[model samples]
Target: MTDRHDHPAAFVDDMSDRAEQIADAAMRLFARYGFKRTAVDDIAKEARIAKATIYLHFKGKDDILRATLQLLGQRVDALCREVMEMKAPFAERLMALLRAHHCTAFLSIGAGDHFAELRAVIDDIAVKERKAFESIFVRYATQLIEECEARGEITLKRPGVDPAALITTLMQASVGAKVGGISYEDYEARLGLFAGVIIAAVLP
Candidate 1:
């Protein structure tokens, strides 16, 4: 019952669109009702798609949860690609990329109880999706640093201090900044300072 030739690219986009919709709806339900309490039927109602239609795109509730986390990763990854093409300076672009990765996830899971529940569900079931996002961020961040160096925007002052190592340190510090229960404003402030410290000696 499908078009004989939906055009491969267009077909893929359509699939992504539907799957993303289902995942979006699921994430809202998971955040509001807790992941365990949110039934597949609830997701179908939220998405306005039949339960059967969801199965066409996802295996079940767990798969839908994974897809929801993946949506966050995709958003960050797409933002990084967009920032890469911007005419902005490396520092500005780097900050945008940082927000693209961190703020995006923060807003997606929301605050307090929502963040706790969603994070627990992700850890319990969608660990790969969570880890994949980190990997995606590191890959892009490392590339951005390399590009900045190549453009003479930055240079490593110390031998053996490479982009990957520097980025890993920045990322670890950024994650550490989230500890001890911080507000969004505090988190953003800390992120700015941490990033500055990591890039200080490298930037002219």
Candidate 2:
């Protein structure tokens, strides 16, 4: 579970304007170079502030990475929630949520070029930050499926299939959508196609 400090929207809410500024700079650099390759000086250079200024806001590189990931989490969290509220068909909203969660993330990291770099260190460094956000994502997806079924907008074609199970399928499919050599357009289209398959499988 996520703590108060890990709240998606509030993760950087308490930061001084300057701290947020520095973290934002670090985020772009980390996206470009990966965590290990990004240093305090690099972040400072990206932020166009003195290296000492970064220390005032963060302890070290890892701390900035946490903040960076949190920032990204906040955006995805907000967008997914927004998509869920759209006054559209359940299937339409489901596709939008997939885009909000996965495609936006892919483009945010520059269409998967350095995804391996920043992502590789995240497993070791910001696992909690990642998990907390993912939990919220899963919750939103599950709720969307359940709500659609309750509204009679859709019914599972098979008995004993949990809405959460559909979410699991979507998650797995999103990974394949980002495989090497695909454009953002292709990644986004693949997600829509995958979600459509899931919906069709359960649509009644």
Candidate 3:
């Protein structure tokens, strides 16, 4: 007789794998021509499968998007966790995680006239998603800040810099670099210096 736990576990694993594949396909298509212009047909073609097959897995295009964004959120959490697990200095781990997020995932997905609609969706979804991301970033950043203070890497006289403000600054800087056409090499150099400065500023 088949063990009930074994069957359920296998079924869940298979579903997760399939969902991930679908998300990957959706990302590629959406990246090519913004999510608004991409159709289920486009995703189906990219995935090399029938449109009906997509329906079997997801409710529709919106469902596909929800899944893709959710996957990204999970990945961000995992990256933060990895950085936190590193034995190096807290500042080093934070820099590594910041650098990882600096690169844009879907280059072709631009704002253009699609900004309003997309922004609305993101704002609503992000209200929830951003909190989760912030929790991860703050947890890691706070630990690093504490470590740096103990080692005299920073000289914070009081509470020092807010972790949320630091994360926002780094994110804005990266976005500005992307907008200004900064080369990867230049961005990396600048990011390193910026990270170091932030560490020093917050260290007490």
Candidate 4:
């Protein structure tokens, strides 16, 4: 039976499907070839679409790269929010935050030699977008730090700890597991020790 409602709905669904297909194709090619080496032709081939069809969706290779990265950053922000929103203890929230980063799509995409290009691309983002990304990290980390402080889990001196500095330190320390040769397990263990030390230093 033909349905009148199906036409518009089907068109929207088709558009969504094609968009996802193109994005997925871009991700795959970019992962393999990095931003500098990945061309519109590579993405089109990976997507099984003509070059013109690729242009119909994305302006060019840079557009595709930006779209892919923005998508990844959004997912990271979401995961961080989920951890912050959890009803668990401070330690558990910290664990969830670490776990989220450990298993995120961004991490998967950042693996291999191509990851340097990903960092370079991030460095190239507009100042506003870059600041927004920084704010997201700060927001999540500040919440975790406050939770730790409230629970007397961390001690601060009379001068007190700078929440922003602590957050940045922890985050950069966490990244060491990635771009460095250290394994996640080792990094996590070290992080636990670092957390303990930080808490002891900050708590009354």
Q: How far is candidate 2 from the true structure (C-alpha RMSD, Å)?
A: 6.4
Top lDDT hit: 1
Q: Arrange candidates by lDDT, descending.
A: 1, 2, 4, 3
lDDT of 3 by residue, 1-204 (tens): 885477998988877877877877886666556677889999888878788878878998878877766676677667667776778865677677775444332232222334344436655654565355445555666666666667777656756466667767776565444444445667667677778878777654
User: Which wins on TM-score, candidate 2 or candidate 3?
Assistant: 2
CA lDDT scores, all candidates in order: 0.80, 0.80, 0.65, 0.67
Stretches of model 4 off by over 4 angstroms after superposition: 1-17, 102-106, 125-131, 147-160, 181-204
Question: For each candidate, how many residue pairs have backbone atoms clashing (under 3 Å)?
Answer: 0, 0, 5, 7
Candidate 2 TM-score, true structure as reference: 0.86
Candidate 3 error regions (>4 Å): 1-6, 104-121, 124-127, 150-155, 158-160, 180-190
- Candidate 1, 160-196: lDDT as tens digits: 7677777887777666666665777787787888777
Task: List candidate 1 segments past 4 Å from native.
Answer: 1-15, 179-183
TM-score, one value per model: 0.81, 0.86, 0.73, 0.73
Best TM-score goes to which candidate?
2
